[model samples]
Structures are given as structure tokens and as C-alpha cells.
Target: MATNTTTKKPAAAALAETAEARPERATRRAPAVVGPPLGEGQEPVTVTLSHHHRIDGTDYTPGAEITVSPDYARGLRGQGFVART
Candidate 1:
């Protein structure tokens, strides 16, 4: 009878090998807003909120009007957060 001999790799070494064999995963980023490009020197627009929301670290209640860049206001409008009026 012949005795069988085998060597087992350490758990950490196996994990490192597995990780290196795998391809690097791409980093996630915020989705880009799809709309017209912002114009230079474009006047800001005032929009009234239809719901309580926060902007630029400032809290705003429903019906509160805040002036922001036209492009930003357009985004809010599209989301139904800003009143149409």
C-alpha cells in the first residue's frame, strides 16, 4: 500500500489568487442628466417646489420658491418636484 501525499494552499493565498485571476470591476458613477447643454450666462429661473425637498444643503418646504440655474430647474420640473406654474 502506497500513502498519498498532497499539499493544501493557505486560505488567504487562495483568496488572493482568485482575486488576481478575476478582471477588475468598473467603478460606478451617477447617471448623466440628458438634456440640452447649459448656455453660458443663461439667466437663472425661479421654480416653486411641489414637494418638500432640499437643494444645495438648504431645506425647502412645498410651495417654497427658489432660484436656480435654468438647467437645474428643468431637471426638477421633469421629476415633477417643481410646480408647472
Candidate 2:
């Protein structure tokens, strides 16, 4: 008669081996947009808000007067949300 024996690896060791066999993925990110600096060579203008609104994740109450770049103020004025003074 003959006897046979087998050995098993521990769970932690098996998991570590599996992890080591896989390659890691590189993280991806959005490309940055290049443009002129804010209010560059442009005069700042003050505008009054017509109603409560959120701009660039910030909230502004109605009748709030804010100083912003001329280009930004023009866009807000066109939308009737602000009146440039």
C-alpha cells in the first residue's frame, strides 16, 4: 500500500499572489484649457443681480452687486440676470 499527501496554501498568501499577477491601471484626467487670465487687460465692472442665482458653484442673492470681468458681465447682462453699472 502507498500513502499520498498534499499541501494547501493559506488564503492570505493566495490572495497576495493573485494581486501581484495583475497589472495596475494608470489614472486618467481631463486636459486643462489654456486661456487668458481672468480680467486681464480688462476693466472690472459692477453689476446688480435681478434674482437669486448660482455662478461657478457660488450662490448670489437678488439685488447683490458683484464686480466681475467685462466679458463675464456682458454675458450676465445678456441673460438679463445682471445689470452692469
**Which candidate leads in lDDT?**
1
Q: What digit string (tens of lDDT, one per residue) describes model 1 on residues 1-85? A: 9876988899999999999999999995322322244479787677788998866455779997777768888789889999866
Report the Cα lDDT for candidate 2. Answer: 0.69
The local lDDT score (0 to 100) that residue 13 gets in candidate 1 is: 100
| Candidate 2 residue pairs in backbone clash | none
> What TM-score fits each model?
0.52, 0.50
Stretches off by above 4 angstroms in model 2 are 1-37
Q: Which stretches of candidate 1 lie over 4 Å from their true place?
A: 1-39
> What C-alpha lDDT do the candidate models reach, one value each?
0.74, 0.69
- Evaluated at residue 54, the lDDT of candidate 2 is 79
